[model samples]
Target: MTKDTRKTEYGNESISSLKGADRVRLRPGVIFGSDGLDGCQHSFFEILSNSIDEAREGHGNVIEVTRFTDHSIMVQDWGRGLPVDYNTKEERYNWELVYCELYAGGKYQNNSGENYEYSLGLNGLGACATQYSSEYFDVTVFRDGYKYRLHFEKGENIGGLSKEKCKYEQTSTIQKWKPDIQVFTDISIPLEYFQTVLKKQAVVNAGLRFILKDEESGETFVYCYENGIVDYIKEITREDGFTEIQFYETSTKGRDREDKPEYKVKMQIAFCFNNHTNLLEYYHNSSFLEYGGAPDKAVKNALVYEIDKCIKNRGKYNKDEAKITFADIEDSLILVVNSFSTVTSYENQTKKSITNRFIQEAMTDFLKQQLEIYFIENKIESDKIVEQILVNKRSRETAEKTRINIKKKLSGSVDISNRVKKFVDCRTKDLLKREIYI
Candidate 1:
């Protein structure tokens, strides 16, 4: 074909769209919700999630995070080093292909027989996106007496992969990166944010040791939780007036049909009610569900249902007064719900919310069964909860009466001004003061 014919194309002034690395560079917000400090922080979480996944799979017991004086972050894990064998299809090392290419990871399997049955990272764009969003990214892997290293500058490879004889005995993977200044103008991660995330990860992956170190200050914080979410709840509500936290966990198995593959669900729930409100944290496969979608609603429904059942059995209220409003239930409650399934679905690429119907159903059923059993087994603790509920109901009633009385007294005392009703006096151009009375 002639040179002129080789480049023929027709469109109404069409332009080529960015691809892969370019797209990620231009649209970091698309991958990480924000291209600011929050997104920079999330990039670290995305990289850290891989190490946490290894811990979840029972391959690794320690994950360490370090913040350097130069504002670079490093995450190291003692898992089997990332696959480094040559790939004929990609004509490159597997580790190189996995990082340089977008949507090229092992967590995309949707079938039951897949290796990643319950994964913390849902999307295929895991570390690759983080690499693209970083100004300098390096990956070092040590495995089977071989050490491999790769480096990239602003998503472009600096050189070919290098391999050498490993000096370390244990297999490990270390990833260190500095965020791109052009993308996130200010990429400083808050120390408290790192602590909160690392602590939560340690709580989720019970036996895993999560370490956070400050290279400048030479200070380190180590988090390891044997009891996981149960301990997390206890620590968060330590200062509040609360009953002993109730904990429940169950695993169930079933298949959609006889011909279909079997699926398993494991759920853990720990909750405590106190006199002060606290945020509820939920995790599906170790990913935080910030939006609290369907599964959160299901858990809340189950709590109200079980609590109401306890009240009715004790004859605390008649049929009309039996209903427990959400306000009453939510006023001072702290809860943590974790669900893991062989097959899970998130609402979006960010994985901020989980949206599987089966998860909702399974969690609701699990909570109701376990909570009822708990109430039956611990009658003394159950009675304390019941008393708290009654107290909440009385307080709500008294507050409502006081509000109405105050409103009535105010209305009876204040002179009704036509300007206030029409909002006319407030619209005036005031030189010194303008007050409208109703």
Candidate 2:
């Protein structure tokens, strides 16, 4: 055996910790989930999420976003500007904790209702991580009758904190940053992303207004929804729905487990059945759940159970017919669920889904009860829903059968009698030696 001198020694000194900006700069994917354009987009959303959280807490009603031709982005919110002064408890500058330290923010004690009742940027890593991954970051906060400013270049603070008396009566926070090319492979987020996200935010935030400005095109777009999801549903269906839209909302408190702390959940649901159009969207804490987890399961379970019961009781199904599935209902149903919880278990930092057991249980139970009441009170609508769902089910079944028949015909064994045009086959039976040419 030969001792290899080329190998590096494994010792205590070899273990090193990433600190400050390096924590996010060195491993951008660990925090933002990507080191490419997606990560840059996530960084933008992080800052936007903070503004959204503040607005949701009733501190603001408007958020402004600007896209510069230089690829820098800015978010301004009329919220209680972030506390960037001093912190007596932590004995550190609030600016340091907010911009320089990860895992530090006011949203951590949400269950206590001290800071935010429901928050989107709950991880506390958004501000610091975004700052660390930016080529240059700037923050301007107006609060406490003073204007506070902080600047960072390449994740390092430039002039610490700049404070001066403010003349404006309204308090606000403005953040501007350019994602660093060094940190991300690409940072050129498109304007369409901003428009879509801002529209979604406006839809979920109800009366809140989002203003987007494109520097390159010199165009400004505004988005606002007075009635939130219900209005959005109407816009999508154009009031051509077969049934009138229904809206239901409720609040509850519970814990995922006996040992877990209890938290509050607020849910709003709007839905209608349309033969020509269909949509289903789920949002949690104002963040769009692209891959809904708890809410999706709850909706599927509750709707299927209730609708199936209604169908069976009304004799809408044919003899020996199977119960309708969610897909059948989905083909003609338009629903939007906006839910917020004091405690959330997001699948990841992206917040595309949630896995809270209590949330699923609560939503499932609440939806079932609402659907039961709705079905009983509106017999005509219930009948129409069942009829439409049945049509969709039968149509899907027919399509499946047709697809299977087509697949069978196409997959039939091709022999000399059924040889396809321009096709050749090998004579050797051995699989290794066989060859088929097109």
Candidate 3:
């Protein structure tokens, strides 16, 4: 096979063999699910996820994504970069293969540990897929106290894993990729989506700093949260659980993995009830797992059972106004449950779901016991929390009923907007002409 004139690697493969046009032309919709804001959003998210992985490993926090006028993009992270080591025999590439080949990555291999105990990029397709979809790709890695660089042009690595011997008196290397305009279709990424991505990342992972700069627009947004979930709780509930629980934190093993060489569970849970009717539960990891799972469910159940038992046995218990369900307490109470386990994977290579169901169950039981003790010991403070939960339960119920009523009222309406008739009769007919709301 004839190699492309660019820096060719030792592989007996040709870029022409990959069928770039044939693969993308017929199935363009696959890489980018749709041709709209969603597809545009995915373009940036794919890169952001890479940065988030670095944050997960405690390697680096600050990630910068810059935009260009012609739609080229650059994403740089100060985290531990993609590893590179020649396969002593194949004389091929290491990290370079990761960029070009399908399902080749440390995250999915189950070989990495520590913060990477779980892999976010499941199927190991994240790198290869993104590279395949883009016009070309470039990667600069700073690892093992050395800096190396590789460039892939048109879904082919021009040169495989070229170490920059003369460059980088600094440790960080640069990665620049020009996205395939044919797939993206005349779009510069929206700033709002980028902000949302960075904000979510900062909230889930503490001490992570992300910066997004639009080179042409001369705009840069920075997100960094040092206090982690505590700050996140404060942002949502406007109440700090720690201010009342003070020096108390209850923890349990949230995930167990014998295969992992070393494993640990660091979980801190605190919650305070407020007068608001809504329930807000914040369960997060360094950069992923916002959705609650068995672990979080287990924890909530324990708290509810403990409160109920306390009220039943002891007559002077708090929450006499309303019987609080675990559901009830979740509302109006700001709960921050964070677990950083030395072992990441509960079971799957994706590491999105936790496998150890018993961990959540164990935590639930432990928290229930301790919550009972804390309540008995601190009557005034604990009772205040109890009363707050009752208030939330009542309000949450009312809110749900109100929503049902509203939906019923709008049953016959064609538009869900508040002013259906007025909206329909607006001066010039132009939802089509309406400014880009989407």
Please, what are the lDDT tens digits per residue for candidate 2 over residues 1-438? 998779778998899999879999999998888999988998999999999999999998999999999999999999999999999999999999989998999999999999988999998899999999999999999999999999999999998899998788799999999999999999999999999999998999999999999999999999999999999999999967999999999999999999999999999999999988989999999999999999999999999999999999988889899889899999998999999999999999989999999999999999999999999999998988898889899999999999999988887854664566565555777898876554
- Across 189-302, the per-residue lDDT of candidate 1 in tens digits comes to 878888988887887888889989998788999999988998888888887846778888888875544675667778888888787756688888888889977679888888
- TM-score of candidate 3 versus the correct structure, residues matched by position: 0.68
Off by over 4 Å in 2: 1-5, 416-438
TM-score of each: 0.87, 0.92, 0.68
- What tens digits encode model 3's per-residue C-alpha lDDT throughout 76-111? 887656667686654756765566666556664333
**Of the candidates numbered 2 and 3, which has the greater lDDT value?**
2
Better of 1 and 3 by lDDT: 1
Among all windows of ten consecutive residues in candidate 3, which has the lowest summed lDDT? 239-248
RMSD after CA superposition, every candidate: 6.9, 4.5, 12.3
The alpha-carbon lDDT assigned to residue 155 of candidate 2 equals 99
